[model samples]
Target: MASCKQVESMIQAWIDGELGDSERVILDQHFQECPLCTITLRKQQRCAALLFEGFADHRLRHSIRQRVMENLPEMEPLRVDLEGVNWRGHDTKPKRAWLGPLMRMAAVFILICLASLLYSAWPKGEKNFDGAVGMITQTEGAAFRETGHGLFCRSVALKDFVKFGAFYKTGPNSHLMVSLRGPTQLRIDENTRFQICDDRKIRVETGRVALDVSRDERKFRVLTPSGTITVYGTVFEVSVDSVQTLVTLQSGALQVESAGAQGELKPGEQTCFTRGQNAITTRTVDTAQVLGWTKAIMPDSEAYDRFAREVQPLKIAELPGEQVFAVITTKNGKPRAVSSFCLAWNPATDGEERCGYDVHVYNEAMHELFSVHVDGSVFANPNRRSHEIDAPGAPIVNAGVLHVKIVPDNSAGKQTPLKVSAVGL
Candidate 1:
């Protein structure tokens, strides 16, 4: 069954007769079972009826028929033959018989001409929406150029595509961050210039960026003026200027390739590669001062207090084989409410065995409510999808753990382990 929130979005389409037959059947079935949705549907229908009535009361003060007809393409004259025997059993010619047919032909011709114009006005730049591998989750005073070769630029906005081969830059004190499909989070600091080459490759021209990249089989690469930095999954910052390129690692490990040599940086380490120099500079550094600006990217703790669980990153199925989270529930006086916002995971390697599992939800009585079956093949990261607990007029009846279980599918025992993070709303 669809969530109440999702069904509400479809209600307007249902009223407009835009829904397909299959969807109509599903909506009808839901209305029969969900009284709350049924009431909402009735309210929406009333609003639509009122709006339609209001439209009926109004008319255009002026007519465009003359202007349109003047520019319309010429049509062949209507040919009507009133040669059949008269219905009145007399040979009286029908009065102005061609006039009715001519009028109908004119109406149809006008509609056809107008439809052609309407279609012509639609944007032809729809191809720009293709090849998107990431989305801008946050932006401030940033500008984006859809194509690297174009001088045209537009102000960046949240949820805008981080399209492949596109250029993005930020002004002083401005910030931009993209949630790549690889589930990597890249925060571009102000005065930065960069372009995304692909899902895992970016070329930096100048300024700095902080990356909290998720682990994957493929390595993420950042190309700078001095060299290229490569790593599987790491938290780090990279800055480039006219003189040299600087890199700092907060967690995990990264390798900088420059001057025909490879250098590695451990946690709390910083390295600088000077332009045209074979020597690489290295030093221990403070992570807070260099990347403290990224702290703004974290969700506010106080604001998320209502959430029963924050984002919990789990490294599942390495050595332990399996893990389960459970807590006994004791019924309280109130009903239970359940809602989750985003759930993401690094998918199994392409064409590799995928781990499968069941995420089960329960009520205060420990009754199974719903289950989300997860696998790497169809289920992977940057998940903005939401799931809501179906409890009619309900709140949490018990003060126990909100999530109930995660049972591994034993049948697919050879499946690869998956890294997952889930958050409650």
Candidate 2:
């Protein structure tokens, strides 16, 4: 016979016939001698029948629990007489009967949240991708209202919803945003399986997911097949597969725990571990490519196009902020070549050695690519008529780069912003 403590969790499974024969036999015998158990079972059956007869679903139960969890924390814990309530031959009547209206309000609230997500996800001339108040990142296709026992979709839903989110899977072409509470936002690549283990922990079983976790006192965790990342508010990524596990930290601080060993990760650091192995080695990473998916748009590759590769005069002045410099540069300047807006400008200092200037190149996303510091002493003529700086270590020249941020020689302490009008691609 099962004890009271043992039967608490099994009651629902037994009611749903999810228990095996041995388990059922044990529970049945115990209930015969236990009035509390028997009474509780009867009430459960009545509630289940009433619920099924009216408006009840697995999702609804989950929704209710989540709502309760979120709001329950704000409420004072209530004390009730458990033994008297479930005793035999007692009419279990509640003291207050305001439950009906509370249920109605909760249902209304759930509906409003669903409607909000639908409106936000549906394209309305422009994406309502505004400030992320909360997150519900999901995959491409969806079938609403589960018809059968299966729910086939992967999405970002129910952030800070007070309960664990079940395992979610994404199929091919499943590049979708990863929204979490922290009100953190991230995106997962395709063919990924992950689960929210708890309020403070998530596990990525396979494939890649990146998150920008908000800084907080709580210790959130991202677990992978290789190791676990204990975060203290950071942007990072984890990937899992048969052979290896990879973790990349973009910013913030985190600790990676591997096989019997752990190490803290610094920003721009990457670490990978082989399956069932302990060795951990870290290397520097170029996050512009690894974390590019998080960007508003892809990195600029137009600089390589034939026409875009040619060099011509940009002949412009000043800088364009916020606007896509790529679009503006393509329209006004020749591709693949970087030229000053004007033919030349004489410096206040009569051309010091090393030009005392070098230019830093960036893609449209403002990721610094390379810096070029020219020795003004290179040109014999003393005056720089057409200041066409060649891209050091890069064959592309300045054709289709986003823009120049800074060009400083060894004297970065006295560095000034590059005054190039436009860089053509």
Candidate 3:
């Protein structure tokens, strides 16, 4: 019914059930009588059964093809003779039997890469806080908690959740620090009691707190006795006394509202709210003065030597080559005020002073509150004290830590250092 050549070509299709009824009938009739073709058909059936059993996952096959198509660049389509030994080569086996094994091996590697890609693209679930908002990251001294039952002092570990309306207080010499899921850090200072409203809001009933907020779109807020502040990704300090509330922005920005009036603050700005009508004021402040709590503990001599070398070439003849006459006035052992450390090498001739010192005065917070440049030729009396010199716009002495840095000026000269101690004011 069918020729040997036709039987050879149609055997695979017949085994796969892809032959039409007439073609199948002809193939069946030929196979019943032809021993050679019957053996070939049996081999084809075995091969098909093995392939289907080995790679039966339909989705896996689809994924492999999809991944290869999507990730690789476009290429020309390739056609292979089903009966050939190999692609593009007549040397392929009689039925191209190597194709199935080659594709199977390739599928293994592709599946690994595709699995990795899919896993990476998958979304991570939302962060869990249980029911509370934040946890205590660090604590020093005794911290107390007020609950519906009663007030109790307890030992807590890091990562203990702080819930809404929970009142937390610190004993003397005690401090508490909190970290939140939003990546916010709050340092609760000594003798402080505050109630948490939410993850981003706090009410300070008393004492002080420092906030270091990471850059984020979410807004943080603080409520004080006399005013409120809305925080926006910045470092700042807030102090609430019985009579007033003080806010200092070391970096970033905030909005202050008090006494029915509102004001905006940028970096190096401060605002004060007193408990009275029309008692709100905002102004530029010295960052070091307000943030004096973070002062570096460098000695006066080291500070002077450091600045001296930094302003080198201009020498102070009154002191050692590496030393400058830098005096720090303190209140209760904290730097409270500073005297102008003057250097007199650049002569003031023709109504211009060339060589001298640029003095920066900082408070205990290590904030440069103000600066003054003492004219080198202006201080005629070497015996005159620093305060006697009438330097314009000199900073007033205040109660707090004081730090001074003097930078030598030889701008009028070839900008070289004068290796001498010119004079001290």
Candidate 4:
């Protein structure tokens, strides 16, 4: 004499296939004897079959089919009133209808989590080859020279003509960002060795160098056979020889920490470090003089004026204050002209001198025709005449100002002016 409530509970568990063999046998006996409960069970079974059939055929359009099926067994038939059934010896409330939505939400959350995990596990691309070797630009004969044992050398083919430094190691040049403030030239003497350690540390085994450091925080490391030099947004020079090392400060400030002792080098100051010694000797020198090795004539009012005076007889001294110089030549008795100027400067402040330059040109109206900021060419010799302004184009025309400034190996922040003028045929 199973109660109606007992039959209903069994019906739900049977539909879900959760009944064990003993419980299933008890429910089967009840269904055979109870005509009313039997009728209700048959109807619910038909509904269950229809639902599953649709799911198996892929005809159910809902995205939450699993969740809907989980709750199907709990649903009552149209003729039956679950409230009248005595559920068990004690009564318990039915499960909430929203359980289906909650289960579906949990499934969605799990899928999203799995997708994120896969994305995070994906492999990244390899690092750039040039970056790994600390080579920033491949200008002139500035190319990477491979050395044995995971090391590389940055060497320039045109030595006397192009005095530029190369990264000598397997890692990216830690000082590559120094170029942004302006071009920096590092001169690595023949048979000298340098190493780029990772992307931040540098080691110089044997060599002499002149560095024009830029005003960037990351551009702050210099190493020598004797010691290491660290800088923060400053211009300076460093050199290393067999017996001693030299460090000169051109502008800004630098702090040298080595051998358990620290020293500060200021503008116009130089420090000498002897091999196997922890002591550093400091002395004062003309900032400009110490940086002269890297200085070269740069395009400016003074250089321009010197060029004009040499090319033409125009007395620039008598020219109106507002008037500027322009280069002119006589072609078949007609005045034909190319208004331009060239100037050079030093790229290094150390013992090694490297030259860089700028070019400027103006029209007849005293308006700037063109201008260009250039460093030593990759194809030109360091000693041979180098032109910073390559064949004139749009950059010059848009410069707008008639006066141009130039600095030669100028770590001192002083710019030389060059004046230009047209020559009369």
- Please report the candidate that would top lDDT against the real structure: 1
Candidates sorted by TM-score, best first = 1, 3, 2, 4
Q: What is the lDDT of residue 82 in candidate 3?
A: 39
For 35-98, candidate 1 gives per-residue lDDT tens digits of 9999999999999898888997585668889999999899965332222211333454577677
TM-score of each: 0.42, 0.36, 0.38, 0.32
Give me the overall lDDT of model 2: 0.55
Candidate 2 residue 209 Cα shift, in angstroms, is 0.4
Per-residue C-alpha lDDT of model 2 across residues 26-111, encoded as one tens digit per residue: 77887888999888899999989988877644445334776678775466544433333234434545743678789999999999
What TM-score does prediction 1 earn?
0.42
The predicted structure with the larger TM-score, 1 or 3, is 1
Ten-residue region with minimum lDDT total, candidate 3:
315-324
Model 3 segments beyond 4 Å from truth? Answer: 1-129, 153-155, 292-425
Give lDDT tens digits, candidate 3, residues 83-155: 3322233454757788989999999999999998665444232232445566665666777666544443444
Colliding residue pairs in candidate 1: 335-395, 335-396, 336-395, 336-396, 337-396
> Ten-residue segment with the worst summed lDDT in candidate 4?
173-182
Q: Mind sharing the TM-score for model 3? A: 0.38
Better of 2 and 3 by lDDT: 3
Q: How many residue pairs clash in each candidate?
A: 5, 20, 26, 34
lDDT (Cα, tens digit) per residue for candidate 4, span 60-144: 4668878888887776534433334323433443455678789999999999999976654442222322222222322222233
Q: Give me the runs in candidate 2 sitting further than 4 Å from their true place.
A: 1-134, 137-163, 296-425
Error of 1 at 86 (Å): 72
